[model samples]
Target chain A: MATKTKPNGKSEKNQPQSTRLWLMFPPKLITRPIVWELGQKFPLVTNVRQASVTDEIGLVSLELSGSRGDIKAAIKWMEKLGIKVEPVEINVIES
Target chain B: MDKQTGFMKALKCRECGREYPLAATHVCEFDFGPLEVAYDYDRIKASMTRSAIQSRSKNMWRYRELLPVAGEPTVGCEVGFTPLIKADRLAKRLGIRELWIKNDAVNYPTLSFKDRVVSVALSRAKELGFTTVACASTGNLANSVAANAASAGLKAYVFIPSDLELGKVLNSLVYGANVVGIKGHYDEVNRLCAEIAGKYNWAFVNVNMRPYYAEGSKSMGFEIIEQLGWKIPQHTIVPMASGSLLTKIHKSYQEMTKLGLVSDAEYSVHGAQPAGCSPISVAQKAGLDFFKPVKPNTIAKSLAIGTPADGFYALKVMKETGGAADDVTDDEIRDGIKLLAECEGIFTETAGGVTVGVAKKLIASGKIPANDSAVLCITGNGLKTLDALVGHVGHTREIRPSLREFEALIEAETKSPTAA
Candidate 1:
């Protein structure tokens, strides 16, 4: 008899997933120059909807929709060039 | 059914637990509680982990399992993963054992935590096919929404109180948003935004797109846990405005625990506010089930919400978490601002001052145990509201070129001991 493997909480390291791209910026990128850099990247980027600054750590959260390949490439390229890029998480409270 | 990219599920109401189709509707029909975006938790829990998150990128989106937007991002592409500094010097001054500061004042674009929420809201807005986005903000939110909207090529409309600080107005206008100076206070502007949400299909991020908007705040809490070796703090101190961020942070901690990314631990959540406008704090102080709105006459403009929509729920959370609320004076707020910068090198805005001031007060009152670790949320940068300290802060000494003259002045100043 074969025992079933329980899926522990672990990030799927080997899976190549295709999903829309979204990025959150560090506080330092909020100045005029970084905005220009972002424009150059996701040109299909319709708008930078929100910009919020906290006391010490600055974060510029951006929302853009593009192909999985282009978005993933853009994220990788930005990270390579020292730009902070991460996947946007979706949260739901079962209230 | 190509699997929607930037979104996960439907919108859920905060009060009645009613669900709505994914769109820009932020309020519910029954009792009018705010609606927020829901997600597929099983999918998120199955995929996200500490190593996966670390390997991805530095921004908040790295925890894509926790955010609402589906597919690839198109704007506000650079945000989140802000510094969670260990406040060693501040701990020494306050006589606390371990203290951390979530420094969001330096957040990119407009410099406040609002960017996190707005980024998600606006991103979802575009995905829902919205060309125009709007909001009712006091200062920081206005600056962020205007700038982000401009960059994303969306027509932006910003409605703010007429008497808002000139710096805030200028920051929003610089982004080329259609800035509307309303005659009433922020609450009036917010009410107007709600009205417009009922009449228009255009996305009002905070009003209609709030479900997605609030998800952004979770990044702050997520970063705190991740930076702390994937462990949640013993206590968290946050300033309450609309009370959304505080509630969201709690949700983040719970989610992490549920996903087994972090262990279950007892945590105390504390809230701070200016004495001039502190409904939540006052309710917490009086041990009441509800909050009584005030006229809001505080220097901490960011925390000056008289009637916070989430006030009651925030009170409930504080009670549930064994947390407490504290208030500080305007002078204390100013002193708190200077103290954090001087001790911790974190230049915080007035809202941050309230949090810091209350943190100090809580420490002195033996409320926050000296042994337990604590994290204080500093919400905005001080530079945006310098007018609050025009005549209060900085040194004004007349110096002469000659050494002899300077020595004489120094001696005189030292002897008198009354020089500002």
Candidate 2:
């Protein structure tokens, strides 16, 4: 299976990239409008594959399609908001 | 196909409520929420009556109306319907008033509760037109998938951690299924299996066939309720692996009530785990909803799923039913196996050991009332993991085949023949 990571450990700045991620939200961040903000703030495509939300936590299976830099920034932003993010297919794929 | 297809209308997302056609899929397209088998309860209500189920075959399929399969079962015909012993001596020993043992330790073919799930999964796998089946198992599931699939004439691929007990590994091999041992923990094996599931079209029982596979565990609950004369026990203590069996048993009780089989009673569900990998227990004790994943390090390899997929749901069921979760140490687990064996004459695997140990602790702490009826779910057979008790259980004397030697040994150990 082909992975979503940039090849050769590098990609042109303007080149488009796409990757699927498993996003985790702590109880405090679960109630926030994090998905809406991510969609509004980033120049990327947000395709949610799965989500589980309870009063204390939230988990989302999301795929973001955009430039590698934008994808990196989006993950950084989510991390800044205390959301734990990881590659969906952790072994073979890189986020 | 079975006429019950009308009863199972669609695969509904547990979180988002999205629906999809009945297929070999486990996740939703939109929210990745688990896809659960949806049933038209009205139709089931009309079709599946108490008398209707009681008159069916004795195996797990007796509750076929509630299972997710579309037709007659194609495998594991002899699985389930294990003895639900009254366990009087064990009950008295544990200081409980009334107790029952839902002993799946003697479960057919594979002597574990995994047979129930594997039976349903493979039957559905055949229904879905898959020629090959696979799974990411710790041990028992691998053994079950191998045995049931082979008997059903379906090729099987069992992936497991390389360090699984020899008994389990050979059990899979003797069934003539292809066994692959990954050089890592069950978590790593699971990750690789997930990637392989995406690459291959095989029916991975616990992965792609999960929706149907999990429903099979409901049969354990069904049998217990029926064996108790159509009444639910006041409490059910179950071992937690991926936390699926505990949740399914709870669903089984709910389904029974919905079908007018058992009286609606206030029953609590408790979960047990080995102390080495008790993520769910720790979370429940702290009153947390989500459990942080842990690195499993326990002799109870079968229940060593560190990050339980259904941990949250198991917690929800416990809270909804006013239940609790707890764990036992390795030493306590060994003591549990011996206690059940000596008192009730039932030998259970470590998962069962954890369950029995937790039940004792719960009763001692008054977390579970000793005055009420409780049922313990003994999921696997002790023979599967003999290493746990290799040096634990022993004979009084290794005597020769002579009556005089035996008599002398008995006299030495018990004081005299007239001691009693």
Give candidate 2 regions above 4 Å deviation.
Answer: A1-60, A64-95, B1-6, B184-187, B400-407, B416-420
- The complex in candidate 2 yields a DockQ of 0.15
Best by lDDT: 2
Q: Residue B183 of candidate 2: its Cα lDDT?
A: 94
lDDT of 2 by residue, B1-420 (tens): 336473688899888898998888887666666789988777788888778878887888888878888888889988999999998999999999999999999999889898998999999889889999988666788888889988999999888678766766788899999988789734345446765776699998877787888889999999999889899989999999778889999999999898787889999999999999998999999998888776788888778766677888999999999999999999999999999999999999888899999999999889899898899999999988788988887644477999999888777768764433
Per-residue alpha-carbon lDDT of candidate 1 for residues B197-309, written as tens digits (9 for 90 to 100): 54678787766677788788998999999999999999999999867788899989988999889999999889998999898998898897666556689898888776566
True contacts kept of each: 0.00, 0.14
lDDT of 2 at B55: 87
Q: Could you tell me how far off, in angstroms, the CA of residue B111 lies in candidate 2 after the best superposition?
A: 0.8
Query: Docking category for candidate 2?
Result: incorrect
- Inter-residue clash pairs, candidate 2: A49-B31, A49-B32, A50-B31, A50-B32, A51-B31, B2-B70, B2-B71
Report model 2's TM-score to 2 decimal places.
0.85
Each prediction's DockQ? 0.01, 0.15
Q: DockQ winner among the candidates?
A: 2
